[model samples]
Target: MTAFKPALILESVDEIPESAYIWHWKTEHHFPFHKHNKGQLTYVEGGAAFLYTRDKTYFLPARHYMWVPPGVEHYFQHRYPANYVRTIYFFTDEDDTSDPFYTRTGIYPVNNLLLEMILYTSKWDGNVLPGTKGYRFVKAIKNILPDISEQPLPITLPTTENTRLKPVLKFIQENLAESLTLESVGQEFNYSERTLIRLFRSTMDISFFQYLKLARMIRAMGYLLETDKTISEIAWDTGYNSVSAFSNTFYKLVGKRPSDFQ
Candidate 1:
């Protein structure tokens, strides 16, 4: 993938900068490594978004969300233009809460209530000052957050330390634009095709094709957002044979056409 410009650290601007905060953006830019004093739940309703931490990379298409516990240092890029992104900062007294996705950063689904509440609260920011009854309407959304804590999350690539698989993963990432195959990669790494398949599927819990598609789609998404390249040009740049092929793959993986992000 091409390099992106440096990310910017955003400062808290909520009038009542206490237990909770809601922020939204619709731009093609990056948020640099920063943390909120409160735990965070991020929602992306339009375009594409990519969240990066020290270890893992997460992809958020439209309608997906990710949870970041308080003080989890991270940065994210607007993977496509016209991004409608919102995040809710939460304050919890119990840091040791037991939720499947709590504190563990991963992409998950968003329900209608979650989506509506986030957008509804965003509208009340400056208009409804704190201590007002309308302000508590936002806090009421907090009660809904705990219910979906156990929802299944789509885990993409996480940084692995295993020496045998580490270099192979790195190779796949570094060569995402190439016509890569498990057999070829395994041959280069001195492993059998079946061994490679098993390792990728069993160890990583993601198949080789799934992982590669993830890489290619990720790069393609960035191209669609950050550059003005034609869809066909991006298709070729990302190893797709044609524009339609790239669009199909993007739609299959991301649930939206390439032009939708454009």
Candidate 2:
């Protein structure tokens, strides 16, 4: 497939000293799977996307929001033509004057208040007259942070004791960058490739190859958030031989291009 880059427009990176930080980007950009070092609170302003993490995959549409903890590798797959994402990176260090980071959470309805706060925060012009309103506004947001964390996990994986599938899943997760074959994966589990296929379909409700792609996409998301690697390098490292091939698949899944992420 031919790779077509998605159009992305990123606003300035707002660096707030010591309290919190925010960044905004508007794009139909589908970024390959990647991760980040900071805890992230992301609101899908418009359009739809999927968020793949180690344990689950979240389908985020308009008005949906997500909270991700630091060091948890994740990525987004865009599902709409014109989606905008506004993300806030809450500094996690306790000594930085803010409270500790919230726990991981995924895909939940955006509350009206939360939505309004997001809009206000996105437009915050650093010059808040020193007063109770600013302090209260920040406090209110902080209070809701935990509520967001309490939202359910977006995607659920099967919890089967099949034992046979464990090693296979582990192998795929570990070798996300490799061109994986069901035959090779089955060999590691001492089963015929056909048997592995049956097991995955019966137990996971998805084909083995589908699961593998999801895994690769998940890993790609982590890299996109955490690293500054070029799109081509990221594609190769994530088992895509060509940037075009990777971008095509990513666009189909994420709805945007790799460059739009940064």
Candidate 3:
């Protein structure tokens, strides 16, 4: 089936209510590549959201949020249905000292304090004008972001446009459930293992194994949030034969067990 396209409002021209605004919705769909005049904060309350930029795909799992700076061209991909996506948009002053956090894009796990603050905005929609209670509350959330969102989730996969690597990456994504390895994949694509490794490093700046692990984790997160599948089922679906092995690797990378993450 073809992907559903959501109507996008370009903040650059849209008549917004104030410097601080909010828009949110829940759907198991995606937004085509788009951008805005003000920086955006996207919080995924259910399921997961994948934010795709020019050369990277970031995984925003459940209970996590992502910050996209102003004018950054990107798109959203939701793998499962009924995913709640909450967004807050705000512009910073030119001389604002905390502008650094508003300049970079990153995925951050939500803490209890921040989570409560974000959920409080659920009663609010549209431009939260200055000098209002809602406006001050949301602005305070933005200001504390730099301090709270210090460590970014490194669940991003570099994308590629190289003719040779593109098809190879696509093949890997399509066959994640299979027993895929560098040697087997190289044979399938008619390359020596060494040559395939070199291609990955040169084009993506990531080793072959590192890329595979991240790709598997991304898929696993989708299954965990989107399905009622057992942990063992999800593990095998992501190419791990042993549940313990899968859980260990997941904890090492995601800092949470599969059960906990779910």
Candidate 4:
């Protein structure tokens, strides 16, 4: 298993002065769990991801945005290889004492207007002249943001206070591509297979096998979008011994053929 490293502070938005810094990141491993003091609005431009906080885990796919409130500790897991994410971190006034805002986590439709703005803002070179087209574009993004919240929390994690399960969860994430069995997982942690199953079901509200499949499917999506590898290659890389089995699972979860996506 590869070591998961802490997130490298990839360009801070504050460094760009008046304009926000829009950046794209491609990740293969779980981003070392961490948080920032400033707020962040992130969108999964391509691939699938699992976002985990102290209280819950949110599954994010394309066309959905997540707003992380300031000082919230959060981490991300790329279920698939070649995970691509676009993020915009805007700086707000520190002295402005505003009401406590809920972290917005929901599935929102991606319209042409939003997609166009994302493309334009992503390439903005930080030259925003007053009363110019770029200036108006920036203003439009801010105006549309308040209307973004359709709900407070969309996908919720099963466990909220299971600190004891952290090590087990981390083990599953780290060894996702390996042929993991309940017996093996239990032996490694000195628990009986039944006990392990009970614990997993109680803590995550999903069976161990289901969680593992979700993790694998997440990684498969990343590979599909980020690499030139064929579907067979991706399936092998993601631990499927048979291409047919991998294809069937992929079709079931993503609702499209891998070749069609390519």
For model 3, the superposed segments whose C-alpha errors exceed 4 Å read: 1-8, 11-18, 94-99
| Best model per TM-score | 3
How high is the lDDT of residue 68 in model 3?
90
Give the lDDT ranking, best first.
3, 1, 4, 2
lDDT value, candidate 3, whole model: 0.82
Tens digits of per-residue lDDT, candidate 2, 132-228, equal 4654575466567665545553343332446777677777877888888987777777889889889988877888877776666655655675566
Deviation in Å, model 3, residue 171 alpha carbon? 1.1
Worst 10 residues of 1 by lDDT: 1-10
TM-score of each: 0.61, 0.49, 0.86, 0.60
> Candidate 1, residue 7: CA error in Å?
8.3
Better of 1 and 2 by lDDT: 1
The total of clashing pairs for model 1 equals: 0
Candidate 3 vs candidate 4: which has greater lDDT? 3
> What is the C-alpha lDDT profile of model 4 across 55-125, one tens digit per residue?
66776665666767656677776664434566665544432134233344344445577767766666554
Q: Estimate candidate 1's alpha-carbon lDDT, on a 0 to 1 scale.
A: 0.69
**Better candidate by TM-score, 1 or 4:** 1
Worst lDDT window (10 residues) for model 4? 1-10
C-alpha RMSD by candidate, in order: 7.1, 13.0, 3.9, 7.3
Clashes of 2: 19
